[model samples]
Target: MSPVLQIALALGSVVGLMGFMAGVRHLAGTWQIGSEVQRKLVHIGTGIYALTLPWLFPDRWPVYLLVGLTLIVMLLLRLPNSRLGATLHSVERQSYGDFLLAISVGVCLFLAGDQLYLYVLPIAVLTLADAAAALAGSTYGTKFFRVEEGEKSLEGSAVFFTVTLLISVICLMLMTSFAPPNIIVLSLMVAGFGTLVEAASWRGFDNLFLPVGLLIFLSAHGTSTLGELVFLAAIFALSIVAFKIVAPKFGLNAHAVRVYVTSIFLLLAVTDPQNTIFPILVLVAHIWRRSVAPCDSKFPDLDVVAALVLVSLGFLTLGKATGPTAISFYGIAAMGMLMGFCAIAASASRPVVRYPMVLALALALFAIREGVVRLNPDSANWNGPMWPAVFICVALTALGPMILSRVFATHRVVKLTFLALLIPLPYYVISTGF
Candidate 1:
């Protein structure tokens, strides 16, 4: 059969299995498995099973049919639960208008596919990493690590990074293996950077940002045909594995220090490929010091710095791909600076704006600018001129607060300034077709 058909079949079978599992659980008298253990088992199992489906069947009809049946069953099961019932009922009552916007966006993304990888990476990060962090934090977290915006445990961040990194590495390796050797390193850099963006993200917006950001990055970097598909499969498998391993480890407070230490080593390896020896040394030292080191204080800020650096590298890699366009280069630099400032400000203040909100605003601004550029008529390429608009925005956003602080002598104005920065988003989206 055709490749598309095979993908369809695989996806279909997976959806069918999920629907079956839900049915079986509902039928079994032991359905009240209310613990995190049970919930995680179901999620992990379903995710793994789903991830393998595309590879197994590779047929579209079966996949679509299976997905349809699964949705139907889910609706049927939720019908009896009052909360779910109410939500579904509300959804049914809503006008098509509510969905039109979302549908349009989806269509646009589908059409843009490779062209929008950079814009989509942030969304993917939000979805996968944020979800992992919340699950890990709520379940296994003991000692709380405070950031400028809020508190997350070292354990939570570790879980988040582990999941993001593993998924990224596997996908990137697969993609790179089939691409030209020159571009392979660039792909790896993109994945590593994308993971960092996810790690630093807050709230649930990482969900949206991660995928969108990755999409944008991939689009800019370009991907080989078979390699891209294989890479996608790797992401699915890695996500499942991360969820399964980390979910169960949540209760192991005794191992938190070990886990954190190991995570730091892995993160270091990701950020600096040349210093492979350093992570080994760090790992040995951490293991040796495990018993003596205090676990009660907080996760080191070094990990955060590493993540930021990776993101910067990814942007730089993309900039390199597009040649030295003054606007594009500067735009990327500006955005990176803005993100760094936001992160710093969030870390410093209590009751500061949430990290996810800040990331969303940044992403939305970047996307709007890109979309606007793509709409330009004079460019031979459909994609807009490689202007440094995003970088410029980032710089202005980041520095606006510092400038205001130095001049107006008040940080309160920083919020307003950031808020004002959002004005360009709606106009850009509406005019640019998404």
Candidate 2:
């Protein structure tokens, strides 16, 4: 059979299972197993079905096919009169979790090559671990923390971290023959990051970020040093403590701490902390974005100098830098900080500002490109070949949220900006060094 046909058949079976789930819901006497559980049932199926795609097709064509089909089905299901649409319409109604699941699959396939460990790890954890977290938190969760997109349960997040740790350790150990001494630490780091991404995910955004985040961490496996692990651990610990003492309103609860920690860990895992500007900027941007309100301060209340000092100290103790590296670091940090301020400023702005904001982003990218070329002429690694790709990515990172903001009013431009930054900027930065 053709690979595409084989994939179609396999997907048909999965849909049949969904139909069975629909039957189970009906026979259980509710005709609806409730919207959230309905979502979970689908989420659980995706975990299983995702495992089959990479194994069955062994190429990206089927993976993209799956993404396209899922997106089409998801949109069709949203039609007001369709039965399946009515069924799923209220399942995390505002978000595109299923669509992101397919995107994650496509991304992993593209980046992972033949590394089944990398491809399967994210899909399995995202599918099963996330489903487990949701079920545990929703059923038994009592303690809640305010997350940017939604409220998360401590119990649920713990469940997510534990499951992700187990999956990463067992799977990666099998893949690389357990070479790294800090495998346990790596597991903890992945789990912590998984929890962090989950906590930050709003309106089903976890579906998109979680797999992508997992792929980034997995790429660094067996290549990270013991000291790097420790440095990442300390960064998270101190940052969470500082956030608690200094900006508790930044959502420095246990769940939020895990998110912040995971981010720093990913950066350390993927690239040098000395050029740590981008990661710090991304983390701070999210915190700053969350800490603001439309009726509140016009200027940010954040202590920028303190954040600068903490990351700078961490980098200095563990990293080596040259003049060019310093310039690149500060340049990226300045652009990111400005983006964050733009997000904060957007909270109260009128609808007419998006075009000018996009135009400003274009001009900023142009100037940043010229400045980077002048100051970092010796930065040939990225500047030589990947410069245009990097420039496009940075521009997309800055402009994406402003464009998306017109569509999603429930989330501020800043909230959208968090995903925008988290997704693309890290990729550009990591590609430069790793």
Top candidate when judged by lDDT against the true structure: 2
Query: Ten residues in a row with the worst lDDT in model 2?
Result: 315-324
Task: List lDDT for all candidates, in order.
Answer: 0.42, 0.61
Q: Report the number of clashing residue pairs per model.
A: 68, 1
RMSD of each: 14.7, 9.0
lDDT per residue as tens, model 2, 9-107: 657854765585566456434663677877777777766877887666655675676677767777676677666554455654466676667666776
Where is model 1 poorest over a 10-residue stretch in terms of lDDT?
A: 92-101
lDDT of 1 by residue, 211-246 (tens): 444554455445545455456446544644564466
| TM-score (C-alpha) between model 2 and the true structure | 0.67
lDDT of 2 at 60: 62
Q: How big is the RMSD of model 2?
A: 9.0
**Best candidate, TM-score:** 2
